[model samples]
Target chain A: MNRFLKILFFALLVKPMVLLGLGLNVFFKAKLPKQGPAIVVANHNSHLDTLVLMSLYPLSQIHKIRPVAAADYFLKNKLLAWFSLNIIGIIPMQRKHIRDTSALFAQCHRALDDGDILLLFPEGSRGKPEQLSDLKRGVHHLIKSRKTLKVVPVMMHGLGKALPKGEMIFVPFNCDVVVGDAIPFNADAKCYIDSVSNALNQLLALCMTRQSVVKDDLE
Target chain B: MFNIPIHSFYMMTFVVILLITGSLIRWRLQVKNPQTDYLELKQRIQSWWWMIGILFGILLAPTTVSIIFFALLSFLALKEFFSIMPTRQADRRILLWAYLAIPLQYYWVATNWYGMFLIFIPIYVFLFLPMRAVFIGETKGFIRSLGTIHWAVMLSVLCVSHIAYLLQLPVKNEQAGALGLVLFLIFITQFNDVCQYIWGKTLGKHKIIPKVSPKKTWEGFIGGVITVTLISGFVAPYLTPLTMVQGFVAGTLIAISGFVGDVVISSVKRDLAIKDSGTLIPGHGGLLDRIDSLIYTAPLFFHFLYYLHY
Candidate 1:
């Protein structure tokens, strides 16, 4: 039933959303490496960001990518719990009782341990829409235990405008997902997260500037 | 049911002529200014082909097909509108219900339930939307979010559905049928937009609404309105049920409303700090952008013509 539900949800619901929900061209600034166990990190903005990022991948490999989301938030209700756990197969990390990191760490480890691509948002909480917030160090802890964890910084532009935090209405906006080259985990928690943050900031800035410069010519 | 309006054929001919003229101008510009940016021009022409093609295809096809085609357009436009709207997780189910209104609204047009069609959205959905959002128990941005969804439905589904509803107009004249009226509204609305832009570029020195729409100029607005009004004196005889004087009034109404719609959408994009609504059409920014004028003009022109016919 779980497998059946997953297939049905992905095939019917998530797959059509790219063409229907965003309803615009979604450009990929950089592509992800196929067949890899990379810990993909991006800044969290809207509830739709995870789904938007999920759409960045091919439908066949969509199953391979599992987002590590806050269990308290996503699992707050039965429907959401079912959606997050079964349909998308997101690895739930506790947010409420998060001081006790052992269990959460174990789940994170288990996800990577199983050769699954673990998606992480280092921002920890929703940031200002269309702007990146402070980057947290949760990702460094996740990859510290694993020897061969490849970390990639993925920047999502415009999902925040599409579905901003605290707004229930999803507005149409252009979205671009830019993935940086994988930085080998050097056990330098601060350095690794900072570099990832910097990479995303550059991409976001570049995207904004290019849009105005190139597109405004028509006006 | 009314006969295939011969004016519909005339409307189609006008569209073909406009397309040909646009192509010739494009060719002239490309040949003359080899270094200029024709990307915008090319995109505009490309989008015109698809838009006019789909429009005529549906207009000429069975009435049912046209209704369905427009319903699909409303869906796409609404979907594009929804992407920027921020909805709560709890309200996803409610949002689904909101989307379902698309077909239901179009169904009213297709079935020709005029009273029910008119009230289903404004009275029924308008009341139900807020209550539905409240039932979901998400309070944050409730009014704004609900209003956004409601406005989206009103604009995309309600306003746009007016075009499909034109098929239901009970005009029996085969030579100048009601479909010609539909084509006329679309023809005038889009051409006014283009004519305004061209005149503005060539002669506009004074800005009309600089804050709202930077491109709009007093010179362009007058030029566009007069040009469309003069053209209406020639074309409106067959395309509409109105007299020559009445056609001029309708033309002026449509031209002004076209400017209003363009500025209205401009204000929206300005608020959102975005360039275009969507990249749905190549030259056009988004589906919403293209139909911005139609949203305002369709219902107004519909009622005016209906009153005149009756």
Candidate 2:
């Protein structure tokens, strides 16, 4: 019943809302990994970002995709935790002070081991609207030891204006999602993190150009 | 039982034949040339099939269904308009209101409330949007934001809604009712576009507006106008209440206005420096890109028909 509900939820609600209600123009869609054992990292802006990313995949692959979300925020309340876990299938990560950091990513590592695709927002939290903030090291930490892991960077534009961080009144906006080629895992943490940031920045630049052709027309 | 008019049946049959012929030609061309790039033509035919399929569904469905379909079209167009054109953060709520006005405007047309349909976007929504933006208290780029938002709504919603309003007109002539008029407007406008492209590609020499629309040529413009005018004269008598001469005049107006509409959108795209409006349609670029000519011809044709027949 839970499995049926998940498919039904994504097929009936999430897909239509993301694909139809808020139009998405995905560029380089061929770059999105078809299978699991991959990390799809994107610059987070609106809550819709996760849904948008998940909706990009086929419904049959819903169970194979797990978004790595901050545990405290999504799991603060019982209802949200239940919905996030069962419905969204988010792999909750502990962001607070921790004695052993490896324990925090155990679930993620297991999911990867199981060949499940994990979605990560390396910005830690939804930053100021559309602005990209500093990259969190959690992604680098998660993949530093996993040399063969495939990490894809996706940059989304205009979703922040659609829903943003706090405002609930949903306004329709055309969003552009550009997917970048997979980045090879680096043993050096900073180098890997910089590579991820650079990849994301390039994807973001692609999204910007995709929306506005006239350079000076953009504010 | 679907109460589809007889004329619509004929139009559908004609479209079927047109598509079959188009496909056959593409196949023959491929077989002969074997190496020519037909990707654009292939995409166009595919998109046309889908578009015509949707049109058939709309025509066969009930009044409410058609209204909702056009409403969805307006929403998509307006979304594309906003998606390409820049908008300030302050007018977010105003944009919401701008979207809200679409349904209300269409509702007026559905109810056959002419007073509200004519004035809602131009008068009420126009004044309300700017005032609502003022409440946001960000005076930065005030005129720029207001002008963009207002013009976007007017073009995407107000202008496009005229097509839907054609459905609401009371039938004066049994030969061609409101649906016929709607069909005549759309068919002729699109026919004008196709003819213009063919004429331009075949005999285009003099550039009409090289900066705005590079593909457009004087030969194409004059050739398309003449073809559309002659064709409209023949088709309008069956699809609309206009006689041969009146149809000729209407066709001339639709042909000229369609060109203007096409060029106007070209200028807008040129200003934005974007190639297409949005990626809604596969071969046709975007919904706005496809309907740009219709946006101008719809209202002009509607008012022309209204003033004459009604």
Candidate 3:
């Protein structure tokens, strides 16, 4: 009976937050990756994208969606440290430190080998909503190093409007998440990075186009 | 230590009936807009489950254990309250007092010292809180810091300590008066929330205060009050020291006070431009979201019962 109540309590608490995110997905018609052991590369718009992605997938798949957040931002305090490691299970990467590059890449590789989904923002940092930032080399190393892994480009639009950088408030707005087909990769390091970056740009453009169409319909 | 009584069984039955009727009504309403309505219904079910767990803990757990549980909840709720509202570095000493005052207040309740419990915050802490700030010697924004700390101490420490105070009530045969009272307030207050939402969604027409809470409607408010009154009129005889009419009136006051509490917290969130206090609870937004209605209802209900029965 105690176990049953514990499970019931968790369901009640987790479902609403998940549904809020899922509601955003339904409104935007979010497309999620169909397979696992893939790298989900999305534009860094806002904090809501992580939840949007988690809600778009099933609970079984949620555990596999390991969001790679900057260590400095997420691990700054004890409370946030617990939330990131235990609640969200984020993969902490040292964004500012060049010395920790190899260790971070190894961690990503371990996650892939364990059949987990890796969520990476290729831009390395949040940028202006209108344009994509230059792709970071982390994506390049992850894809080329692992031959079996797939690279799926995801574009999250309107999260900047929903909750932007340095803003505490979150306005309810239509945010779109588009998951494109996997970009094929080979062992060639340079080619793999270029191909993934190009695919990500294309997916982002599609998201922008879809957002405009939505705006037209609303108007 | 399990000291489950016959009354515990009665409370369990009451909760079960509430869950069934509430869930059935909520589920039945989702025929039109299935997605959003379904989500809302799911949240209601989850809230009910939490309510049951808390009720069970209060009823079955040992006195020491339950008091600790209430203390922990007060600490968290108080922490969440202060985190959202702006505070100054100068207010640090007052916050230290706030944390220290929680255990001491609950100690008064646990020992059944009604007089000390009542005046601990209003008389003693009230006088000392500002003095602690004065010692800091930072007069810059002094009034604002003092006001914020005083409000926090009142709401988080004084208001919530009433739950502990209920545990101290002396009844014939040393019956579970405190537990019953706590259970009574929690059940009626949260049920008011559920009934109001259900009532508003169905028969709602005119918005009560569209600027403060767009979802609240007069139809829902009336329906919620009537339902809570009817339920309390029947249930209070068993769970509380009040007569039938007194219970009904108490329930009505709870519904009204709960509505104000919900709106007041919503206004604060609006000022901060955030949604859902924090993401601690699943269906509920945060600890604050779950307890927003209780902030006013707990204190009011305690005082009402205290004056009449104690």
* TM-score of chain B, candidates 1 onward in order: 0.94, 0.96, 0.88
lDDT of 1 at A216: 18
lDDT of 3 by residue, A1-219 (tens): 433442343356445543442223232234355566778887786777776766666554566778888999999999989777766668998877767667767778788778788899878777654356777777877665566666777776656654556766543333456677777776666676677677766765544223221121122
Could you tell which candidate, 2 or 3, scores higher by TM-score? 2
Mind giving the per-residue lDDT tens digits that candidate 3 earns over B1-310?
2554445456767788877887777767776567664775588587767767775766567776777777767776665555455555345456667777888988887787778988998999889988888887877677866777678678777887777667666752224355777778888888899899999999999999998889999999999999998998887877777889989889999999998888988887776565765545667766778888888999899889878876
- RMSD (Å) per prediction: 7.0, 2.3, 10.8
Clashing pairs in 2: none
Q: Return the top candidate by DockQ.
A: 2
Q: Write the per-residue lDDT of candidate 2 for residues B140-178, one digit (tens) a residue.
A: 778988899899999999999999988888876575655
Q: Which candidate has the highest TM-score of all?
A: 2
Better of 2 and 3 by DockQ: 2
Candidate 1 vs candidate 3: which has greater DockQ?
1
Give each candidate's fraction of reference contacts reproduced.
0.14, 0.35, 0.00
* Model 3: lDDT of residue B243: 85
By DockQ, rank the candidates, best first: 2, 1, 3
Total residue pair clashes for candidate 2: 0
Chain A TM per candidate, in order of listing: 0.85, 0.93, 0.79
Candidate 1 has an interface RMSD (Å) of 9.4
TM-score of 1: 0.73
- TM-scores for all predictions: 0.73, 0.95, 0.60
Comparing 1 and 3 on TM-score, the stronger one = 1
Cα deviation at B298, candidate 3, in Å, is 1.8
